[model samples]
Target: MIHVLFVCTGNTCRSPMAAALFNHWAEVMGMSSRVRAGSAGMAALGGEAASEHAVKAMARRGINLAHHRARPVEEAIPKADLVLCMGHGQAQLLRERYPRFAERIHPLMPYAWGLRTDVEDPYGGDLETYEAVAEKLEETVQSVLQKLENSRET
Candidate 1:
């Protein structure tokens, strides 16, 4: 099994969106059995529900994060096979904070989406902004799952 943990600043926007989308993608690709996806944050407070915009954005994709509660990276680090951070800074922070897991930590956009950029947070952004972020997350998640699926063959 492959466990992917998506990380962001607060776990209320980007990471939650990415993780839910990743799970949807896995289900669509018939790879749900082999892939596990979740989200956390660098500075998140525990038990906070996903942002309303995040919930709405996911509803548009038929995925739900209405019940997703924020978790700190510590709770997620030990279980993740791959740690996909929303930006280079987040990845760098993880590398510094937990050097032992450095090898598995990576920037989500550049590595998964080939954007050479970051997935910006839409924490207090409008619905349109959240929708756009969701779209990008879906795109990246597809690529990530595809790469993981391919890797299993070797």
Candidate 2:
């Protein structure tokens, strides 16, 4: 199975949402058994739950966030076959901090769809911001799924 790790500044928001959304998508596409997905933060404040706005925003898309807990990137990095960051800066930081795994790290947008835009952090922002971030994440996740499929076929 391919292990995919999604990361951000804090696991309380973007990364968790990315994990949940991708997991849900994987299940729907019947690819969950072939791929293992999770999320973590570069400097995680562990044990924190996802923000209320983030929960609600994902709920609107039928993705649950109840099982998420903030975790450190180190916890997931070593095991990941692919480490996807929400932004280029995060990818740079991961590569600089963990040079051994640099080749496995990538910005989620460009890695998935060749789009270089970062997924904006919505922490402490309004629900609208959270929704916008989720929408971008969903689009990127779809692209990621397609990429994974093509790779598997090869």
Report per-prediction Cα RMSD to one decimal: 0.9, 0.9
State which candidate has the highest TM-score: 1
Q: Which residue runs of candidate 2 sit more than 4 Å off their true CA positions?
A: none
What would the per-residue lDDT of candidate 2 be over residues 30-136, giving only the tens digit for each residue? 89999868999998988889989889999999988976789999889999999999999999999999999999999998898788798899989999999999998
lDDT of each: 0.91, 0.91
CA error at residue 58 for candidate 1, angstroms: 0.4
Model 1's lDDT to the true fold?
A: 0.91
Quality of model 2 by C-alpha lDDT: 0.91
Model 1 vs. true fold: TM: 0.97
Model 1 lowest lDDT segment of ten: 111-120
Clashing pairs in 2: none
Q: Which ten residues in a row have the lowest lDDT in candidate 2?
A: 138-147
Q: Against the correct fold, how does model 2 do in TM-score? A: 0.96
